[model samples]
Target: MAHDVQLEAITYETKEEVPQELKEKKLSWQKLRRYDSLDLESRSIPGHHHGHHSKALTRSLIFRLAFQSIGVVYGDVGTSPLYVFASTFPNGIGNNDDILGVLSLIFYTITLITVIKYVLIVLKANDNGEGGTFALYSLLCRYAKVGFIPNQQAEDRDVSNYELELPSGRAWMASWLKSALEKSMFAKQILLFATMLGTSMLIGDGVLTPCISVLSAVGGIQVATTKVTQDMVVWISVVILILLFLIQRFGTDKVGYSFAPIICVWFALIGGIGLYNFIQYDPAVAKALNPKYIIDYFKRNKKGAWVSLGGVVLAITGTEALFADLGHFTVPSVQISMCFVTYPALILAYAGQASFLRMNNDLVKETFYKSIPKPIYWPTFVIAVLASIIASQAIISGTFSIIQQSLSLGCFPRVKVIHTSTKYEGQVYVPEANYLLMVACVAVTLGFRTTTNIGNAYGIAVVFVMTLTSCFLVLIMIMIWKTHIILVLVYILIIGSVELLYLSSVLYKFDQGGYLPVAFATVLMIVMYTWNSVFRRKYHYELEHKISPEKLKEVVGGISLHRIPGLAMFYSELVQGIPPIFKHYVANVPALHSVLVFVSIKSLPISKVPVSERFLFRHVEPKDLNVFRCVVRYGYTDVQNEQEPFEKLLIENLKVFIRDGFGLPQSVLSNGENGEEIMDVRQVEEDMQPAEIEREIEAVDKAWHAGIVHLIGETEVVAGKGSSIGKKILIDYAYTFLRRNLRESDDVLTIPHKRMLKVGMTYEL
Candidate 1:
C-alpha cells in the first residue's frame, strides 16, 4: 500500500556538491527563482565540516583530556570497590572458593564487557563523535530509511558529517535487515521503543546511581566508629545528596577541575592499598585471573554463583558513561586513561579484597572497610565519600544532557534548559529535572536505607542498559560499518551471553527491590511514546491539509483583503506550501502582512549547524507577491542564545540573500555578521536594474523598523469524534495535560506578549 501524501506538495532536488559554473553566474530575480529548486547548495558556506574525531591533538592536550576523564568518566566505576565485595556476599560467603569464583567473574566481566565490548568496539560506533542510544539511532537513520517520522528531507542527508560508507561485498544479512526495517512500520516502532527504553533505563540508572554510591561511601562511617548508627548513615547520605545536586548549577568547568585531581589521588590510593593487601595478606589471589575459575565457580555453587552475578555486575556500573562521555573527550584520551590507570586499579582492588577474604571469611559483609590498613583508614574514608559524590554528580549531569537531546528530537516534552556554561556546549541544567532528581535520590536513600537493597535495584537498570547497547551495536555493525555476518555473531556469542547472564540474575531478584527501575522506566517510556506519537500525527495532518498555491493566490487576491504595513513571521511545521492555519486566519481577519514569511524551525541529527548555512530561503510563487518560506535548521546540541533576537538574524540574512542573489558565495556577506562590507549591485547582477535591488533592501529595512510580529499557532490536540475510547483517553487527557503544563513556545523564545500574535487552533487526530 502506498503512503498518503498531499498531491500539491512541492518537491525540490538537493545537490551535495555545488557546480563551479553555477556559482560564477549572475542570476536575475527570475533566474534566481529557478535556481531555488537546487536547495541553495550553490552558496559556498563554511561549517564544522570535519567529523567529530577528525582533529589532531597535541601530546599535552591528550594527556590533559585523559586526566580530566578520570573524574567525569571513571568515577562511578572507580568507586565500585566500596560496595562490590559487600553486595556479592550479602548473605555471607559459603567458603573461600566462592570468593575466588566471584573474583574471577568480576575480572573477566570487567575485562570482557567494559574493556573489550565498550571501550574497544562500541565506542568506535559513535555517531560522528556523539555516543548514546539516540546517537546510534541517528547513525542508522542516515544509513537506512528507518526513522519513525516521515517528514525527514533529502537535504538533511547533505550535512557534511552525515556520511555513509557502504560495504564493497554483497552482504545479504545487512541488506535484509535494512529492507525489513524500511518496509515495515512495526519494525520501526519496535526500534523506536527499544531506543526509548534504553534512554529511560539510563535516566532510571541516573537516579539509582547517586543513592547507592553515596550510601555505600557514607556507610563507612559505621565501620570507623561503633557509636554511629544506620539511621545516622542514611541521614548523612541524604544531606550529601542534597548538597551534591545543589552544586549542579555551577557546571563541570568549575567542579570538574577540582574533582580530577581528587579522583586521581583516589585511584592511586586504592591501587596502592590493593597491591599492599595482595602481597601482605596472600599472593595466591593472583590465580583468580585465570578463566577456568569462572567455569569452576558455576559448577560448584551452581545457582548460588548464578544469582551472585546481580552483585558482580555492579563492578562495571559506569561503563555506559565511558561512551556517553565520548563527546566531552577524545577516544584516544579515554582509551589511554582506561588502559593505563582505571583498568589496572580496578583489577588490583578486587584482587586485594578477595585475598583479604581468603584469611578472614567472617568479615565478608564489611570487607572493604575492614580490610583497609589502619594507618590511612581515615584519609581513605574521606576520599571515598568525595569520590562517590563526584560519581553521583557525573550521572546527574548526564541525565540532564539526555533529556535535552530527547527534547530536541521531540521524544520528550518542553523543559527549560539552561546552558550552565558559555564556554562548553554540552553543559546544561534543567531546573525542574534537577529538583525532581534531588527528591527521588533522597527518597531512595531514606527508603532503602541499605546499599544491599539498592544494589539489587541498581544492577537491573545497568545490565538492561548494557543489553540494549549490545542490541543497538549489532544493528549498527551491520548497517553502518558493514561488518561481515560471522564477525557480528562472534560478538553476540561472547559479549551478548555475558550481559544476558547478568540480566537474568538481576531479573531473578526483581521481587527484592529490583522492580524500582523497571517501573520507573515503564512510566517514562509511556510519556515519551505518547508525546512523540501525537507530535507526529499533528505534523502529518498539517502536511496533508496545507493550502495549495492556487488557493493561496486566491486568498491574497481578494478585493476585500488588504496588506498590513509590517513583516509577519508565521511559524509552522510545514516546509512546503501555505499552512492551513494561514488560510483560516485570512478568512476571519481579512488582512495579511505586507511582507510574510512562513518560518519552519527544524532540528537535525548533527551536533551543530553552520551559521552561514543556517537560514534557507525560497520564494512563494509569483516573486512580486512579497511572500517567502524560510527553513531554519538547528542540530541536536545547538543552543539558541536568547540575547540574539531570532527576528533580527532572519532579517539580516534575508537582506544578504536579496542583495547578492543565490549565486554569490556566503563569504561575500562575511557570514551574515554585522559591520561587513555590502557589495555593489553593479558588481553582482548585470541584468537587473541596481535601483530595483536597492528598493527591495530598503523595503526590508522599513518593515524591520516598522515592526516585526511573531505569528505562532497554538494547537490544542484532542481525539476526533470517531476515535476509539483508548485513543481518546491518550490524546484528550494524557497528552493535553502534559502540553498545558510544560514550558510554552513564547516562554522559550522570550518574545514579549505585545509583539507576539498567537493563532489558536484545535486539531482532532
Candidate 2:
C-alpha cells in the first residue's frame, strides 16, 4: 500500500557520483504547499478559501491574504519614513544638508538597493520560492561531493566496501549528517544573525514606536483641543508599549484570524489615499524606477553620501526576514501583496507627507497631524500607527524563526523552538528566543530613548545576511549557472556596490549606538562557527577510532554473559559503529530480570510525535538470558538517556515481556492510557524441566489488562533531568491469567470479563 507522500520527505539531490548500488534511489526535497493539509478541502470549516463563494468573496479572500503579507513582510520599511526624517534633523524635519542627504539616501535606497537588487536579482534565486539560509544551503549540499561524508566516519576506512553495499547505507548516512549539521550548525548561525540585528532594532523600535507613533498620534489630538503637553504624550505612549508587551502570551493564532480582515481595511485606507494623490498630482515619485537617478542622488550629495547609506538601506530593513520566513505564506502572495497594496500605500503616505510639509512647513513640528485634513488625518493616523504595531509582531515572530534556524544549523546553543500552528510546519514560537529578543529590544529602546536614534541600528543584520548571501550565491552561480566571468563580475559589482553603500551609511549610526547590534552579531557568528568546528572534530575523532565490522562480529559471537539473569538492553544509535554505547551502559548498571531496548528516534521538520514508527521486541541474549527488546519514544528533545526511556517502555511492555516469554508489542502499547493488553494468560511460572511432554518450554504470561490512571505532579525541572516525573498507568491486569487457565484446562470467566471489570472485583466461579 502506498503511504501519504505529503507526510514523506523526498530528497532532491541526484545520485550521479554515488556507486551503482546507490544509484537507483532518488532524493527530492520537501514540496509542502503554503498551507498544506489533506483536510482543508473539507466542506465544513467556516471561511475556508473556497466552497461555493462568489466573485466578491473571492476578491475578499485575495485581499485578506495579500494584506496580511504586507503587514508581515514590508511593515518595517513602510514605517521607516516616520523616524528617518526626524533622525536626520533632531529639531524638526528642517531642510539641512543632513536632511537632504538622508532623503537622497532614502529615495535612491528604495530604487537601486530594494527594487533593483532584491526584487530583480535575489528573490529570483529562491528554491521554488522557499527562502531562508538553510533551504539554500541544503540545495547546495545536495550537489556537494561524497568524499565529505566518509572523512567524517571512521567505519568507511576501506572505501571499496561502500561500493559493494552503498544504497541502503547512503540512506542511513544522510539521516545522521542532516541531524547533526542542522541541529548544531544551521540553527545557531541563523539565530545569531537574527538576535544581534533584530534584538537591537527591536529595542530601538520599542522605545521609538511608543513615543514616536503615539506622540505622532496624540499630537494629532491637538487639532481638537489646544492643550497637549510632551509629558502627556510620553505617558500615553508608555501605556501603549506596556499593553503591546503584555499581549505576547496569547499567541497570534486567534489574533491572526482577526488581524487579516483589519489589515485589509488599513491597506484600503492607504490605497484610496494613494490613488487619489496619484490622480491629482500625477506624482513624479514614479521616477524612482530608474536606477540612474539614485546614482545621481549619491553623486550630487557627495560630502555626506556615506552618512546617507544607513538611511537608504532602511528601505530594505525587513528583506532578510522575508527570506528567512519564506516558509510561512507563499512567496507569490508576499511579493504580490507588497507590490499591490503595501508599497502603494507607503509611497502615497510619503508623497502626501511631502506635500503637507511643502504646504504648511509647520507640519514638521514633530506632530503628524498638520499634514492632512483633520477628520481624514485622525482616522488614517490611527490605522497607520496600529498597522505599524502589528508589523512589529511579524518582526518578533520572524526573529524567533531566524534564531531557531540558526540554532538548527549549529550557529548557537540549544534553545527551545515552539511551533504555534498545528497545521503549518513553519509557524514557530521560541520562548527563549522571544524573551532574549524582548530584553535586547527594551534595552535598545531605553538606550536610544527615541526611534530617531534607534533607527541607525536597524539595517546592520539584513546587510550582513545579504552580503553573505551574495558571496554564497556567487559561488553557486559560478558552479551552477554557467555564466561568463564578465557577467558574473557585473552582477557582483551591482550587489557589492549597494551593499557597500548601506554598510557605510550604517557605520555613521554606530556612535549613535549602531555598534550595539553589530557587536551582538559578531558574538553570535563566533559562537556558531566555533562550536561547530569543535563538535565536528570530536565526532570525527571518536568514530574513526572504532574497531572494524569483522572484529565487532567476533566480539558479539564470543559473549558468554547471555545466561546472566536480567534484561540487558543496548543503547543503539545505529550509526556507522556497532552498539558499543549499549554495552557501556549495561556494563555500568547491569539490572537483573530486565528487558533491553535499542532505541532509534526520527524527527522531521514537523513537530508531531510519530507513534507508529515505534519498534518492538527482539530477544537478543548476550549468551541466552531471554532479553526482551523495544524502541520507545519520549519525543525529539527529551533528555532521558537511553536507559530511562527504554526502561519505562519496557515496564509498559511487561505483558509482552512475559507473553512471548517476553515478545514485542507495537499496537497494544498505544491503545489507551497504557494500551489494550492482549486478552490472554498472565500467571504461568517458568517450567525449569528441559524435558516436558512435547510442550513449548517458554514461560508465558496469562495476559491481564490494566486500567489507565492520570495525575499531574507539581514540580519544576532544575536544569536537565528533563521532567522530574514520567507517569505510567496500569496497562494490563489479565496478561498472566489465560496461560494459567490453558495449563489447567479450565473454562474462561465469561461473566466478569463482559462488563470491563475494574480492580477489587471478587467473583468465585
Candidate 3:
C-alpha cells in the first residue's frame, strides 16, 4: 500500500469522543479553550509589523551611497593625521632625516596595507555582497563542508548568495581541496577556531577605536590653551563617548546622513592645509615618498625605528571597516570614495604634517594644531571633534553587525537584535552591546588619559585582526579563487610579512598597554568557544537519536489519539524527522492538535534571504494526518520578524501550499473512499478564485481564533553516565551555568507567554 493510503486509513477522533484515559492526559486543552471566545478577525500579531524596505540602485542612488560611504567607511583612517605624528615621535624631531623616514614609513604602510591589500585584494573575498571575518568564513564554508552545523540541506545551496563558480579548468583542484577539508573533523574545528578568534579581536576594536579617536581629537583643546589640562581632555572625551553610545538606538541611517558632509569638510581642510604647509614650510619633505628613505630611517635608528612601527600601524587602524561595511555600501562605492576622496586627502594631510614638523621641530607634539595656519584653528578643532565622533559611530555600528552575524551562525549567545532602519536591513542596534561598549570606552579614556597609551593598545588589536584576515585570505585565494600557486604564495608572503612586522613591534610594547586587546580577545575567545562547543554537542546528540517519520506515524497510529480544534507549532533544530522532544510530549499528553507543524528555522550562508524564498514546505505523511513540516531559512543579515508578522506570513504560505499541493501529482489527491479520485490539486487551484482562497484563509483564521500554542523543547545537557570527570565539569557545570544566565529561547523566539507550551527534556551527551 502507498503512504497516502496508509494515512487515509487512520481516522481522527474529535475531542469529546476521546477515551477517558486520553482525556485525563489532555490537560492543555482546557487552558487552550480559554481563547475560544477571543476575536480572530484581526490577522495581525500584536507588536509585530513588517516595515522592511528595499531601494533600487539608480545612478543617482549609487552616487549618493558612495558619498555617504566617505563618513562611515573612511573616518578612522581619515582622522589618523590628528595624532599619528605625535604618537610616532613622542619627543621632538631629532633632524630632517628622522622626519622624512617616519613620513616614508607612514606613506608606504597606508599604500601597502590600506590600498593594495584591502581595497584591491581583501574586498574581493566578501561573502556574496557582504564582508567581514564572518562573511569570509561563510564563503569558505560554501566551498567546503566546514560549518559547525551538520543538518545543511540541498535546498540551502540554492540561496542567491551561496553561488560560487570556479575557473573553467581548475575544478579538479578545487574539488580535491574541498573534499580534504570536509573529510577531516579536526580541520573544520581549526577553521572555526581561527574564524572565532578573528571575530573576537574585531569586537575589541569597537572598544578601542572610540577611545583613541575621541581622546586624540579632544587633545587639541590642550594644544590651543595651556589652561586646559589632560584631566579636562579626559572628562570631555568621556562625555562625548557617552553621547555617541546613547544615540545608537536611533541607528546609522539617521546618524550617517550628516557624517558625509562633516567628513568632506574635514578632508578638504586637511588636504589644503597639507598642500599649503608642504609648499610654504618645506617642499623638500615630499622626498618621504621615496622607499629609500624608509630603509635609511630604519638603518639610522634600527631599534627605535622598529619600535615606532607600532605608531605607524595606526595609519591603517580602521582598514577593516572598509571591508566590514561592504554590506552597508557597495564595493565600487567604497573603492571610489577611498581612492578619489579619502586616499589623496590623507596622503596630503600626512605630508603637510611632516613638512610642518621639519620646519618647526620644537612643536613636534602639537604638529597638527600648530601646522594649521592659525586663522582656522578653532573651526578646525570643532570639525576634528565631529569627525572623530563619526569614526567612532562607524565602528560601533560594525560591532553590532558582527555580533548579529555571530548569533545567526551559532558562535555567540542570543541577544536582542533591533533593526533600526526600514531602508537598510544591515542598520541595527543592540542595546546591551551598545551600553557595554560605552562603559568600556569610558574606562579606557579615564585609565589611559593619553593617546600615547591608548594608541599602543589600539595598534595591537588592529594588527592582530589584519594578520588573521591575511590568514583567512590565503585559503580563500586557493580554495575559492583557484589562483596559481606562485601568485598565492606571493600574496600571502607580502601581506603576512608586513602584518607580522607590525605585530612584533606592538608585542614589544606588551607592558605599555598592548596587553589590553590580548586580554579582551582571550575572554571573548572563551565565551565563543564555550557557547559553540555546547551548541554543537547538543545538535549532534539530537541528530544521533532523531526519530524517523515512519516511526512517528506508527506511534500515532498505535493509539486512539484525540484531535483538538487548534494549531500547535513545534520548533526544532533538526531539519528532518521528528525530534525526541515531540515523542516525549505525545507520550505524556496522549492528545494532539488538529493541525501540526514542525518548523525548522535555519541560517543559510548568505547575507539576505529574499522574502519569497524564505519558506519551504512539504507534507510529513498526507493531508489527512494534518502533519506538515516547514523549513524557514534566514540569511545572517536578515532580521527576524516578531510573532504576529511571522504567523501571518506562515499561514499565507501554508494556504498557497495546500491549494497547489506544492505541485504534487493529481493521483496523490484521491480520497481513500473505494480508491476514488477527488478533485485534482491543479484543477482546484485553477478553479479557485480570490474569494475562495480568502474563504480558505478565513477558515484557518477561525481555527486559529480558538488558540495557537508554540511547543518549544527546553533541554538540559549533561555528560553521559560513563563520561570522564573533565567532561562532567565542562558540560554539567560550566555549560549549564552559562545557558542559565544567557538570553533564553523565549526571548529569541518572541513567543507570546499565554500561548506557549515548553516540554522539558534531558540529554546525556
Candidate 1 TM-score to native: 0.90
Of candidates 3 and 2, the better by TM-score: 3
Residue clash pairs of candidate 1: none
Sorted by lDDT, highest first, which candidate order results?
1, 3, 2
Write the residue-wise lDDT of candidate 1 on 1-765 in tens digits.
001111121344334433443344554223443234235433333232434437778999999989988989999999999999888889887877888888998999999999999889988987767788878877776677776532235445555565555555746767888898889988877877888898899999889999998999888888989899999999999999999888888776677656889898999988988898899898898888787888888898889888989999999999999988887888889999999999999999999888899999999878888889999999999999999988998898889888877775578877777777776667778787899899989999899999899999999999988998999899988876778789998999989998998999999999999999999899999889788877778777887788877787788877899987888888876666567888878878898878888887767666556666667777565555677778777666666655546788888888777765643432332211343343333444553456776787787787778888989877888899999999898899888888888778776555678989888888878
Candidates 1 and 3 compared by lDDT, better number:
1
The alpha-carbon RMSD values of the candidates against the true structure, listed in the order shown, are: 6.1, 16.2, 10.2
Write candidate 3's Cα lDDT for 480-506 as tens digits.
888877988898788788999999999
TM-score for predicted model 3 compared with the true structure: 0.87
Pick by lDDT: 1 or 2, better one: 1
lDDT of candidate 2 over 1-765, digit per residue (tens): 000001112221111111222122222101111110111111111122311112233555655555666656665565555544444444553332233334345555555556666655556555433465544443344333211111211111111111111133234444444455445655434433443344334333333333334334444455556686545544555565556655655565544435555566666665566455445543544544445554665576564555656645655666665565555555556667766665666556555544444444454544234444545876777776676666566666665555554443333444445555554445555555555555555555445555555556655555666776676566445543434568778977877877876776677678776776667755555544443443233333324443444553343444543322233333321222333343333344333232233332222121112232233334443313333334333221212221224334444454333333322122212222333322121121122122331121232111112221111111111112232231111001121222122211001011112322121111111
lDDT of 3: 0.77
lDDT of each: 0.79, 0.43, 0.77
**Runs with alpha carbons beyond 4 Å of true place in candidate 2:** 1-68, 88-108, 145-246, 274-301, 360-362, 365-369, 483-487, 526-534, 537-574, 578-581, 592-765
Off by over 4 Å in 1: 1-53, 150-152, 170-173, 557-559, 588-592, 643-645, 663-689, 752-754
Model 3, residue 642: C-alpha shift (Å) = 3.5
- TM per candidate comes to 0.90, 0.61, 0.87
